[model samples]
Target chain A: MQDSTATNARDAGRAAQRAAEARPVRIAIDAMGGDHGPEVVIPGAAMALQRHPQMRFVIYGDAAQVEPLLDGHPALKAASAFTHTDVSIKMDEKPSQALRLGRYKSSMWRAIQAVRDDEADACLSAGNTGALMAMSMFCLKTMPQVERPAIAAIWPTVRGESIVLDVGASIGADASHYVNLAVLGAAMARIVFDMERPGVGLLNVGREEIKGIEAVKEAGRTLREANLPNLDYRGFVEGDDIGKGTVDVVVTEGFTGNIALKTAEGTAKQIGEYLRSAMGRTWRAKLGYLLARPAFDALRAKMDPSRANGGVFLGLEGVVIKSHGGADVKGVAAAIDIAYDMAHYQLMRTIRDMLDETPIATAS
Target chain B: MQDSTATNARDAGRAAQRAAEARPVRIAIDAMGGDHGPEVVIPGAAMALQRHPQMRFVIYGDAAQVEPLLDGHPALKAASAFTHTDVSIKMDEKPSQALRLGRYKSSMWRAIQAVRDDEADACLSAGNTGALMAMSMFCLKTMPQVERPAIAAIWPTVRGESIVLDVGASIGADASHYVNLAVLGAAMARIVFDMERPGVGLLNVGREEIKGIEAVKEAGRTLREANLPNLDYRGFVEGDDIGKGTVDVVVTEGFTGNIALKTAEGTAKQIGEYLRSAMGRTWRAKLGYLLARPAFDALRAKMDPSRANGGVFLGLEGVVIKSHGGADVKGVAAAIDIAYDMAHYQLMRTIRDMLDETPIATAS
Candidate 1:
């Protein structure tokens, strides 16, 4: 497992495709995951296959339930190898219950195990995040310096895209944890944005006069002073800075990060609703909506959550991508796309090397 | 001091206007405050005076700087009484430093002091928020049960409006503090919504599988179990609920609350930018924009921050309204309008009575 740091994402993608002609990148997917289960997951893999022609999938689920769905998509059927599993983890099952009962027996566990066993480059699941996370951490242990695995989401910003991490993996972070998140997020930014060094910032309250949470401030102080190997630490950024793409990586403790992420999403949906309701007010406006519907559709497509579907479980020994349970085939494909790209670029190797090379100290 | 808790805001407004015919509502304005100094504040006061005909102002600042601006507006000059002060608090001044240097000397300090000294029914400032809070807390003092004062903002929701409190007055709230914020927000909602009982919810991370921050979860549990006076506790709400109008009062500690508030505002601005760029993309889209400009204008008006201008400092013995520092005449007028209504309806007395009557214990 060598570092993929020498090449950028585009160059890596070209190299991966060239390698793909020789030995295809294998991805294990939890087929019985998410709301639509095999219905979306099957077609989604086929859709992803079109994007990555030299990719293979290890599908884990009840064969009786999965085989017929695979039969519908001959392209996916050719690319996939199905594993028979009797048990499927429920979406609402507690992490403890899933660990106690399902363990390595369930489809979700087996998919993650494919990564741990080095049979597959990565695993993708559209299931309950907590269960997926627990199973991933248990099956694929975290890297040496990593204490807790974080969920990194791809955020759409004014400057295109940025990576935000620790979006509710585990709560309460120290300066070290914040620094760890920064390194991991920046690494992902390189893999995704094709940048060698990515700018990172710590999230804090925007009030000018008042001090932020002690831990966040401490993290900010440490980041500002420390000479992190690959990360370009830009000190403090506020909640608004996230959408503005003020930095490539916006790092925060799990709790605040989770709240801010969801708040921004909620605000977007709220404004969308306001726009729709306003457009339907009059006949003239309704006609305008029909005439300008293409632009609105383009806007909607840009704002689509499906386009940015995956949440990479960072800090784990193996790569795991979490897809939204409620996501459609398009969304599932998007998640798979991320999982493939991460694996293709060897994102895990890059982050591990960065963390080993430089430990972000709290003081200096 | 009397509690006007018997009637709703509509009836209260009608009665208040009639009472103003008998005795004018006297308000103290920090004329030297905000970005534009007395230029915006003077016209803002005059605009407010037009709405509340019998309202009188005690404008505090340098007489030379204040009187000329007021003189430009004949209506404001007739209703104003000037109190010259040598100092004006800087917009970026620290709360502690403002207290040390500007206390009872600056216009901001004197306005709040006027409220405390019974010279004015309410005090309004468009200066530094932290300094204003410190001065308000220092001069006005907290009510019987409140250990910390909260700044309550009127958030525009799908169902019209809701009150969200502790939007950065102070940070770190206990379970008891959450309950206090709920009670305070609910009381303010009653004044704004014209409803006797307002529903309150504690903001928590939306994830179903994972538990939220201990403080937030504890606050939610406390709010769920406890029965706050004149408040309907709806257990927990996610960040999305702030705009969904899911609850009349959203209770959160200052830190999370402040982040959420700014995040929403930033997202709104971001989306607005997206719309502008997309609409300008093509000639047809521009034509459609022209046709639907009125509807878009209505939506803009609805999303206007100026319309929801003041954040009231609740739990203080006296009413203190903090306006946005960079607000124009219309926005500042909105702040004064809120001050007039709060004073006319005796919001200070209502909160005091509510706190005294119900301490909002952490648990039942």
Candidate 2:
């Protein structure tokens, strides 16, 4: 009986080793990217490790700073490997300057390079968006059938969640680019939601067929006529439809997408402010708030922006997740969570396969 | 003593008559325009009359339908004059159809005609926007030095309200049109908020002067260099600034403006849903909600879309206020209130005078 138990333990060890060898997702993080830098990113990585035990991290920053922070948490220290880099990209530095001067030296550059070198499954950053995008485009390049990359955000909706694309990757997408966004965004929605056929819509001012601009109209025409296989092209969706979860994917040019995102964020914050002021009006209201504090706390957790933190850059050969520069420890963890999921699901491979199969005529 | 009292009464009557002759504000209403038609409009007019005793209304629709609704409200009956019109434009009618078929005979057309004929000071309608704009443009025409009219909405902000323009008036606007929107929006702000120098901003994706498109870039440059009077052109604002009340006027082309407006509305509704579900979670929460019902009611009123329902079409020869299609009595009242306010302050005349005095290089 003792020999049988020993044999069982040996079998378990072999199974664990085989599993690691089969496929292990590793996320490369820009440790010196955001406002708090290593102070926030290290703790965030530690917490993330608790949730995702299989996940491994390669943190890029000054070794002196990042190592000390990781030491405070043994789990993160055990799961992570530090890559020393003295140079860090400044938050205000222009994309051109960052690319020209700190190409291979900067933490942002090295983090992205890890993914390109096949050392990491995905790269996550809370750095300067423009500089990051420039570096990413330069290093990874565009995927097959893609002219430009787009930032896809998991937007919270009334129904559940929807993916919105081109939330400030580049501005002024023509008809072809709009159609491409639909294809790319649908690829994201499928992997994120585990859906076989996701519904995609072009973001417009109105749902009426005759309402939007020429580019949007042409994109709608193309989407309708082409009949893509992976996604159900649900012609046009308005701004309100986004929060209502009218479709699986909402696609638009960068300018409009960026404005819409910021607008929604502002509106949510505004309503929150209104709620706070309302509940604090009278003594009776205050007591009521205390009694219902648990419910409110639950709602707060549900509405927390950290849960919807990551913006994955699609149409790139490698996966890249961008977190808000001002995001705290929780937000950083949220972004890393996205990176882990994308890598585990082989999101980049799926996107490449889908693009190669997609029959877009204007994919130049 | 009796003779002196008689003399004082006579003098007061003459003074009142002179005041009425000087500038009496009159609003024209399309009684059969919205979902509930006269049922909501007459009651709303009555409510508005309670607030503005000096204002009068011209009701246009089937006299048989409108008269009875006004009959129950003696105040509205006393404050309004009815014009019979058997034809009413359908809510789904196209702009071309509205202009072609319902030109002179329809209630919507005649209501706008009132403003043109000087029978009413301004026009108010809770009808299809496309149809209303068509009929308005045909009847009143664009003002001199104006290329096209734009819809300006009074957006509720943390600091009172700000005017956001081109909210689905036209799809695309050039640099000249953006400059025109700023001037036109500022003019409305000056009259509505009683500010001599309203702060105007071009709504863009970012606060950075280099972030937006060519048109917006050129507009910013022109505004900064021109140093226009009656408005302090404060460069560019972001989507969130509209709700934050960073400026008195927010300018954008129709597409972005409409989407931003609708997105904010959707976000507001989304938060409200979250709030409702949260408060209904448990018996304790239910009891707390009951106790804090008054505070919630106040907050609801403060966030009420009805209070900010009116979308005033500016740069037209006359004022035309558009209300939401599914508006209730309170919402209808809000539109009428805007009409009354615009007429009382002679908003159109002020806009024209401002245009004449302004030195815009592209006033063609």
- The best candidate in terms of TM-score: 2
Model 2, chain B only, scores a TM-score of 0.93
What is the lDDT for B209 in model 2? 78
Residue B179 C-alpha lDDT in model 2: 85
lDDT tens digits by residue: candidate 2, A23-74: 6788999999988888888888888888898888888999989888988998
Q: Where does candidate 1 clash, by residue pair?
A: B9-B194
Q: Each prediction's Cα RMSD?
A: 5.1, 9.4
Considering the two chains of model 2, state its CAPRI-style docking category. Answer: medium
Which regions of candidate 1 fall more than 4 Å away from where they truly are? Answer: A1-22, A207-210, A361-364, B1-22, B207-210, B359-364
- Determine the backbone clash count of candidate 2: 0
Interface RMSD of each: 1.1, 0.9
Residue-by-residue lDDT tens digits, candidate 2, B207-239: 777777999999999888888778899989988
Question: Which window of ten consecutive residues has the lowest lDDT sum in model 1 chain A?
Answer: A1-10
Q: Score the docking of each candidate (DockQ).
A: 0.61, 0.58
